[model samples]
Target: MKKETGRPTQLITRKFAKELHSNFMKYRASIIAKYIKKEDANAVWFSVEELENYIHYIKSKGEKTGYDVNGIRIYFGVYPEQRKYAEKAGLMTVFLQATGKKIRKAAKEGEVQTLALVMDNGDGDISSIEPMNYGSIGRPPSLLY
Candidate 1:
């Protein structure tokens, strides 16, 4: 229970660890929701770089499981500021709607699936390029497919 530095793990039980994990998850959800809402209000398109920066900012707050590039891209829509930059950089930009209790509830209920829709604006025409499923949060039966 004691560490090399003399800290005691006994001071923190499994229950504490579990509670901490839950709290952290809640905090992460809140942060993601805040940023998403801000983006929605501004009507600003975010590139992958911007997303990464956002992730980094979150991590700086001592949050674990900070946004993984691949993981995040699975649920947000890509809207690269400069299509050429996205192509040259080999990354997709995206637009993320604010994550709300409603969406979270749907995700948990299996009534809806969170998807990352990638758009390609070629010749000034916006079109769906790809869509990726991130994960389901709700009921087991509803999450199928």
Candidate 2:
């Protein structure tokens, strides 16, 4: 099958990952730490299964849009700064967005369709959706389409 014009998956080297992870740690401690919970001031990670299943769900839900389900938008997000949402208050995170062409093609249709794979708005908890990993960051950069 032919591919469509959209995001492309990217791969990074372990050396590069290490450098990036180091940068993240520095940046988090210097800037993001104060705004978020102490425990949350590290990394936000999603397992391979979690991501793959979400992609499957997105494709299934969109149901053969012909737009080609081969891209995604990972948006930087922040938990609302409120007492009620204290566990995630002002925390920085990323959202893995729509991969279905129906959702991606919305850009061409004058409006963009977004599907943030967060628990409040996705199916199957997406592997617990936001299981923030409190560890080092950086990995081979994967630009999935």
Candidate 3:
């Protein structure tokens, strides 16, 4: 079979999308209720358009910085109460990618870091690509709610 070089739309699935959204709502409801005002309605998920645009931007920016551009780490975030946006304390997404050599070194050194990266074993098996889900905090731009 010929390897299709373009992005694979065949991989998309509505079933999982709905399931993940439902799961997020189920698990995240309390946190949203506590952190965001009732009117704020913290978002359960982000639109694909927003996510795709951000991914494209990451790829472009990563190439400019001369990195192999292996991955993007999306962190969950919220605007603080003092934030002027309507999404204050609402869901936000922070996109992190391989920026510079310094970040890679920090990951390798295993030092205590809030700003840190984890490099895969140099053996080339990217086991991290396996299905797993998680998030961390950040400030808001596009609110999830």
Best prediction by lDDT:
2
TM-score of each: 0.19, 0.51, 0.43
| lDDT, model 2 | 0.50
Per-residue lDDT, model 2, residue 80, is 78
lDDT of 1 by residue, 14-101 (tens): 7877677566446643464466442211112345776666555433332222221222232334334466643222222333321111
If the candidates were sorted by their lDDT against the true structure, best first, what order would they fall in? 2, 3, 1
State the displacement of the C-alpha of residue 49, model 1, in Å, after optimal TM-score superposition. 31
lDDT of each: 0.34, 0.50, 0.45
> Per-residue lDDT tens digits of candidate 2, residues 1-76?
8757776478787788888877766665555555543534345667787777777765665454333344466666
Deviation of model 3 at 135, angstroms? 17
Residue 110, model 2: lDDT of 41
Query: How well does candidate 1 match the true structure in TM-score terms?
Result: 0.19
Candidate 3 residue runs with Cα over 4 Å from true position: 1-12, 34-57, 86-91, 94-145
Show the lowest summed lDDT stretch of 10 residues, model 2: 118-127
